[model samples]
Target: MWAFLHRFASPPHFYRLSGRMAPWLGWACLGTMLGGLYGGLVAAPPDYQQGESYRIIFVHVPSAWMSLFIYVVMAGASAVALVWRMKLAEVVAVASAPVGASFTFLALVTGSLWGKPMWGTYWVWDARLTSELILLFLYFGVIGLHSAIEDRRTASRAAGLFAIIGVVNIPIIHFSVEWWSTLHQGPTVTKLSAPSIHLSMLVPLLLMAVAFKLFYVTVLLMRARCEVLERERNAGWVRALIAREGSE
Candidate 1:
């Protein structure tokens, strides 16, 4: 298993593998997103309390979930790059930052849209919201730090350290509602027992979450492939690959 894993640490191998997998993942993401959106928007009944405004959760909840999920992935890749000095891992970590940042931004926007009708305000300094906002800044910090450094390896190391340090905030974001008084609601789908949401609602929510994960995989692979090509531009294999494509 270690040998198999180590083989992909090679940039050429990962570049080829990711290119082959991206198309399939993209199609799957599209299919799942369409299904989820249809079910969430058309099939599911309105909430007894919030009514149509609650429909925003189809987009809001998935984006919020992806925000945390992608950060964990970024941090994990950063750790591998730091410990193993793996180029592919560094590419993955950097490729994921912008995507994660986009998700975080989407979550904040959708949450604000949802809040206007529910909370009677567009923004608040509630614990959960505040922590999530901090997360967006952390993402910006990583991106800015990575771009500012002249050396790619050094930049990866710097960003990796920051990501590792920032991971502490994930737990804070997750438990913010439970640990403190906040306008945000607690977990409905991730509870210890059965989820509190109805099955019809739960299915679409779960589907959307899965679709978002697939979307991340699809975009991450594409971005990582681009990063790999840029880093490997001077390599013989890369030049040969480009020549072969041009010839064809």
Candidate 2:
């Protein structure tokens, strides 16, 4: 088990694995996203109350879920890097930030657009909204900090510390609707009983969530490969890997 882990932990091994995995992940993500989009926008029935406005849930909900999920992943990676001193994990954490941030921004914007039509307002200080906005800021902070430092290791450590600390916000953002009386709606898909939303709406929502996750994995692998190459430039294996990659 340790041998397997050690082999995979080597930068060259990870780089080669990512190369093989990326295309498959990318194709799967594209297929899933296209199907989910069609299902959500065309097939899913409009809400009786919110009418067409609820259609935004297809994008908003999935992105929101991804924002929190990706952060947890980043934090977990950062924790591993810190504990095990794994440069690959740190690179992954850094690579994942921007993608997750873009998703978070999409969620915020879509949520605002959806809200304006239904709630008659584009912005609010509600707990869920506020916490989510803060999440976007957290992503920005990590990215910004990384860029500001010239030293790669220093930047990684700084961003890693911040990411680990900011993870506390994820749960707060998730449970904000329940913890306090807020304008945002409570849980629909998550409950002991059956989902509050109907199966038609639920199906598309789940599909989009899965699509977003797959997309993240595809992009993360791509970016992590680049990161590994840059970091391991001096290594003999990296030079050989580059030659092999170029020939292929």
Candidate 3:
């Protein structure tokens, strides 16, 4: 077990493994996204109250969920790099930032679009919204800090620390709607009494979430491969890998 684990930890081995994983993940993501969209947009019934407007939740909720999920993943990667001094871990955390931030931005924009019709306003200072906004800032800060530092090792370490420290905000962002009375709605799918939403709605929401997760995995592997190449540029295997890729 230890031998297998150590062998996999080697950069060259991991790089090769990740390359093989990427295409599978990509196809899976594409398939899941198609299925989920079909289920959400066409198959799901309209909400009794919100009517067609509730359809937006299919996109809005999943993007928002991804925004939060990716940040946690980035934070976990950052922690691994900081603690174990893993270069690959740092690369993963760095690579994940922009993707996570983009998702966060998508969430905010979609939420705003969904909000206008429901709340009669495009913006609000509600707990959930405000906390999510702050999450975007955190993503920005991590990315900016990583770029600002001249030394890659130092930069990664610094960013990793920031990511770990900033993790506190995640819980606050998650529970804010419940912790304090706010305009934002409380837990719908996460409720203990059973999901507050019906199966028709729930199925789509879950499907979208699965789609988003698959999408993230596909993108992350691509980014990770890029990162591996860049970081391992001077290595013999990298040159061979590049030559092979170029030939193809």
Candidate 4:
């Protein structure tokens, strides 16, 4: 098992394996997103109160979910990298920062757009909103810290520590609506009880969540492959591969 894990963790092996998996992940992402959009927009009945504006949930909710989800992934990867000194984990942690940041930004924008109709304003310093904004700045700090350093390993470790510290905010953001009196609504689809949402709406929301996760994997692999090449460029294997590709 150790041998297998060591082999799997090697940059070349991961590159090849991720290359094989990315296409499938990309296709799955495309299919699910299309289905989710169609189902949410065309099939699901409009909310009795909010009407068509609620359709933004299809995008907003999923993006919000992804923002938190990807940060958790980064935090976990960073932990592994710091503890085990695993280069692959470091790469994954760093590669995920930009993607996670983008998701966080999207969530903020969509949430603001959503707030205009529901809250009668485009912005507010609600608990969840404020915590989420902090999360975005956390992502930026990780990214900027990673880039500001010259030694890649040192940078990853530094950024990884930053990521680990920021994880305290995850639960805070998730439960903010409950912990404080926020304008944001409480849980509808994710809770201890059966989801409060109807099947038609729930299905698309779940589908969009899956699609976003797959999208992250597809992009993460692409970014990791590039990272691997950059980190390995001076190695003999990389030189040989580069020569072979050039010949072909």
Candidate 5:
């Protein structure tokens, strides 16, 4: 298992493997997303309190979950790159930033849309909301820092360290509701016992969450593959691969 793991650390091997898997993952993502949307929007009964407006949860919840999930992935990849000097890990770390940022943006926007009717205000300085906003800024910081540096290695290392440091905020974001009184609803689906959500709603939410995860994987692989090619452009293997492609 360890041997196989190390083998995939090779850029060429990962590039080929990801290329083969990405298409399948892409289709799976689409199918699951469509299924989840149908279930959430059509099949699930409207909330007794929030009514039809609560349907936005299908999009808002998944986007919010992905925002945190992707950040953790980026930070973990950064840790691996820093400790092992793995080029693939570095590529993955940087490639994930934009995706994570986009999710964070979606979460924020959707949260605001939900909040307007539910909380009677579109924006607030609530703990969860503020920390989530900070998360978006952190994503921007990582991308900006990487682009500002000319040397890729230096940029990656710098961004990696920053990501590592920024991880402190994740727990804060997760626990912010408990740590402080806020209008934002607490965890409904991740509770210790059975989820508070009804089965009909839970099914769609879970499906949407799975779709988001698969979507992230599909896009991450595509982005990491492109980053690898760009970073390895001067390598003999890259030149040979380009030549082969051109000839084909």
Candidate 6:
């Protein structure tokens, strides 16, 4: 398994494989996303308390989940890059930053929209909200720090170190509601016991979550492949790949 991973992690091979896989991932993302949207918006019944406003959960909850989940992925990849000096891990870490930030921004916006009716306000410095806000800034810091330096290797190491250190906040974001008296609602879908959500609602939420994960991987592969080409522009394989493209 390790040998296979080491082989697959080669820049040229990963680029080729990811290019072939992207279309399939795109189709899957589209199908799952459509199903989730239809289920969330059309089929599922409204919440007794929140009504139509609750529909935003289909987007907000998934974005919020991805916001945290992607950071952990970045931090893990960063650790690998830092410890093993893996170029692909470094690329994955840097590539994930922007996508993670976008999701965090979406989560914050949707949460505010949902909060308006539920909390009688658009924003608050609650534990989860504040931690999530910090998470966005963390993503920004990684992207900015990486770009600030001209040397790609040096930049990735610096950014990877930053990502590893910033991982302390992930658990804080996940457990904020339980750790403090926050305005954000506690987890209903991920509790240890049976989910509090109805079957109708839970199914769509799960589908949306799966779609988000697929979307992230699809985008990450696309971004990472481009990053690889830029990093390997002078390599023989890259030149050969360019020749092939030109011939076609």
lDDT (CA) for every model shown?
Answer: 0.93, 0.91, 0.87, 0.94, 0.94, 0.95
Instruction: Tell me the tens digit of each residue's lDDT in model 6 across 80-133.
Output: 998999999999998999999999999999999999998899999999999999
lDDT by residue (110-141, candidate 2, tens digit) is: 99999998898999999999999999999999
lDDT: the better of candidates 2 and 4: 4
Cα shift from native, residue 179, model 6 (Å): 1.0
Model 5 lDDT at residue 197 = 90
Candidate 2 TM-score versus the reference: 0.95
Q: What's the lDDT of the predicted structure labeled candidate 2?
A: 0.91
Score candidate 4 by lDDT: 0.94
User: What TM-score do all the candidates reach, one by one?
Assistant: 0.98, 0.95, 0.95, 0.98, 0.98, 0.98
For every model shown, the clashing-pair count is: 0, 0, 0, 0, 0, 0
* Candidate 5 Cα errors over 4 Å, as ranges: none
Give the per-residue lDDT digits (tens) of candidate 3, residues 2-95: 7886787678998888889888987887887788788888998888888888888888888888898999999999999988888878988998
> What is candidate 1's lDDT per residue for 1-248, written digit by digit as tens?
88988887788889899899999999999999899999999999999999988989999989999999999999999999899888888999999999999999999999999999999999999999999999999999999999999999999999989998999999999999999999999988877988899988989898999999999999999999898999999999999999999999
Shift in Å, residue 133, candidate 6: 0.3
Instruction: Give the range where candidate 4 is weakest over 10 consecutive residues by summed lDDT.
Output: 183-192
lDDT of 4 at 156: 95
Q: Order the candidate numbers by lDDT, best to worst.
A: 6, 5, 4, 1, 2, 3
Residue-pair clash count for candidate 6: 0
Give per-residue CA lDDT, model 5, range 1-248, as digits (tens). 98898888788888899999999999999999999999999999999999999999999999999999999999999999999998888999999999999999999999999999988999999999999999999999999999999999999999999998999999999999888998788988876877889999999999999999999999999999999889889988899999999999
Q: Which regions in candidate 3 have their CA more than 4 angstroms from the true location? A: 244-248
Which residue pairs clash within candidate 3?
A: none
Q: Tell me the alpha-carbon RMSD of every candidate.
A: 0.9, 1.6, 1.5, 0.9, 0.9, 0.8
Q: Candidate 6 lDDT (Cα, whole model)?
A: 0.95
